[model samples]
Target: RGLFPSFFREAQRREVLLEDLLYVSSAFERIAEATEEMLAEMEDSLRKPVDPEEFRHFWLALAEDLEREL
Candidate 1:
């Protein structure tokens, strides 16, 4: 029947959307974890003595790496 075909199509569309959403959610989780780890490392570095120029370069490189991962 026509109604049955439409129902199946809509269901398929919803399934695809759900899959996309899950993939995005996983990506966000990964990004968040990576960001948290980076922040913790920065915090630890702050607790110790670090050269300003060295820290600046390290921070910039970390930012670039984070941007690529995201």
Candidate 2:
């Protein structure tokens, strides 16, 4: 996951001990799972036709919130 790569690099750059880094890296799995679920939901939504303007707004808001969450 992008978060892991960036976080791992940051921890290493700061000379964090491997044990500490390992603990921090443990959170990556949950983050990755959440990301995958969100993507899959978006893909499923795209499989069906929806009102263009409404769907656009829905996806745009979702994207904005996800970006903030990430």
Candidate 3:
């Protein structure tokens, strides 16, 4: 069984090629990288002393950036 059996079956019926799968795999990698970077920034912020309002703004901005990426 595959992760998305129906979708995979449809894709196979459509004769989807390896390159198409690779392209989607790469896109997912990019999204994962962005998420990791955002989490690292948040972790660093927590390690340091920051003003409450400033931290809130920083967190919100990071969240927005992540939303845009996804």
Worst 10 residues of 1 by lDDT: 43-52
Query: How would you encode candidate 3's per-residue C-alpha lDDT over 1-70 as one tens digit per residue?
Result: 5669988888886666677788899999999999999999999977997799988999999999999999
Which digits, one per residue and each the tens of the lDDT, describe model 2 over residues 1-70? Answer: 7999999899887776776778778788778999999999999987978788998999999999999999
Instruction: Rank candidates by TM-score, best first.
Output: 1, 3, 2
Candidate lDDT (C-alpha), each: 0.97, 0.88, 0.90
Q: Candidate 3 — number of clashing residue pairs? A: 0
Task: Tell me how far the alpha carbon of residue 29 in candidate 1 is from the true structure, in angstroms, after superposition.
Answer: 0.6
Q: Which is the leading candidate under TM-score?
A: 1
Model 2 scores what on Cα lDDT?
A: 0.88
TM-score of 2: 0.41
Q: Rank the candidates by lDDT, best first.
A: 1, 3, 2
C-alpha TM-score for every candidate: 0.69, 0.41, 0.48
lDDT of 1 at 59: 96
**Model 3 CA lDDT for position 14:** 65
Q: Which residue pairs does candidate 1 place in steric collision? A: none
Q: Ten consecutive residues with minimal summed lDDT in candidate 3?
A: 13-22
Clashing pairs in 2: none
